[model samples]
Target: MALPTSPPEPARLAGDNWLANCAEWPDLVRQAWRVEALGTIVTGTRWLAAEAPLVVVLAAMKRIPHAELGPVLADPTVEKGWWLVPLDAADHLSDIRQLRVRPPGWPLRCPPTGWQLCGRFWLQPPDGSGLVTAPPLLGAALGPGGPRLPAEAFG
Candidate 1:
């Protein structure tokens, strides 16, 4: 199965307006992006790479406010997760061992906002507001092992 370098001008999505305008996601509306050999050329924002478990740990932790949650993509095959953070997030996440701030112009496999295409799924779908995980908080929560959640975690 050939994944699209771009999905067919993705059908009207919930955050299309913001993605198209605010986020400046290139070719989001005009191009025909489909699951092919490659995915989308994510622009205007940056990404953080980590294991799926750690990403899940961060999402489930009560300490990390729900509002802080942003767009997260999960690759079941690799059990890896991709987080859409502010473009400058690298400065904050670079120090963390469990996470790697993707370099500029990174190509992430973003299938869409609301569906799991192929093995990629959105753990936290984009909402158009463009608010993503707070890097500082993410850094503080991460440890050599993984997220240091409070006693009552994964809620």
Candidate 2:
């Protein structure tokens, strides 16, 4: 699919949100897979690219207490969050290829063997299949920006 020329609108989910407004393309979603974990929380930084807009989805895993503030103190709970960032084929060519060439040690229990380049996002399925570059769509709906996690994701 052609790179979205203009930014799309954003979509909101329970633990995820799209930074850009993108259409809910069934085909793309069908091709997409959920990323359950990462090598480190810092890996989320790699998802951001200047070439194209990326959607970063994050989910909270567990909660912890703030040492500075006691449990009885004001809002002192902290949550461990995971993130999923989508990359565009044209924009993140180098980064995507590099990951495939030399898969990094992400803090995942079962690291991804490879990635699937769907319409606009780089997907990593639970299956161990290697890299897959999707064929371009003639008239695929390229939505706005991309997905993002909630505020808690950063903390």
Candidate 3:
């Protein structure tokens, strides 16, 4: 005789769709599971993020007015942080030598929304509303990185 199968649990069902901001969300969750470190994807869109030392990241976070902050991913192991910003961030932050504005189409590995812990986790997770850091505010907070230096400046 064939046995009946039970449906996936309620919490299991809700968990899967909470961060369904993008179309690939379900697949991304599966990918997160495959990674096993509880990480999700920060991809698509015309956005670019600024990757900087943890200190700088925190500094900017503090400077942003009010209590309103946006999604952020942090990696303690590397002492680095990434902030989700608009597409124009590249030109706005061009002077920042201490940071790197990730090129668009870069698939950043971040923790799924909510309180997830791993080597690389979200400092500020997405709020399920697809909100991102305001570019002008972020730019103002970090100020300018000063002009880019010549290669020999490092040597």
Please give the CA lDDT of all the candidate structures: 0.56, 0.21, 0.63
Top-TM-score structure, candidate number: 3
Using all chains and alpha carbons, the TM-scores for the candidates as numbered come to 0.65, 0.18, 0.68
- What's the best-to-worst order under TM-score? 3, 1, 2
Put down candidate 1 lDDT per residue, 14-109, tens digits, no spaces.
444444343345565324234332236455453443333545544444345567776666777776786667777877777667677777665565
Candidate 1 at residue 114, lDDT? 48
Residue 11, candidate 3: alpha-carbon lDDT: 33
Provide the lDDT at 74 for model 1: 74
Residue 53 of model 1 has an lDDT of 57
Q: Candidate 2 lDDT, tens digit per residue, 50-103? A: 111121111111111111110010011221112222334333334331122112
Error of 3 at 91 (Å): 1.8
C-alpha lDDT (0 to 100) for residue 67 of candidate 1:
74
- Candidates 1 and 2: which is better by TM-score? 1
**Which residue ranges in model 2 land beyond 4 Å of their true spot?**
1-37, 41-88, 91-124, 133-155
**lDDT at residue 14 of model 3 (Cα atoms):** 44
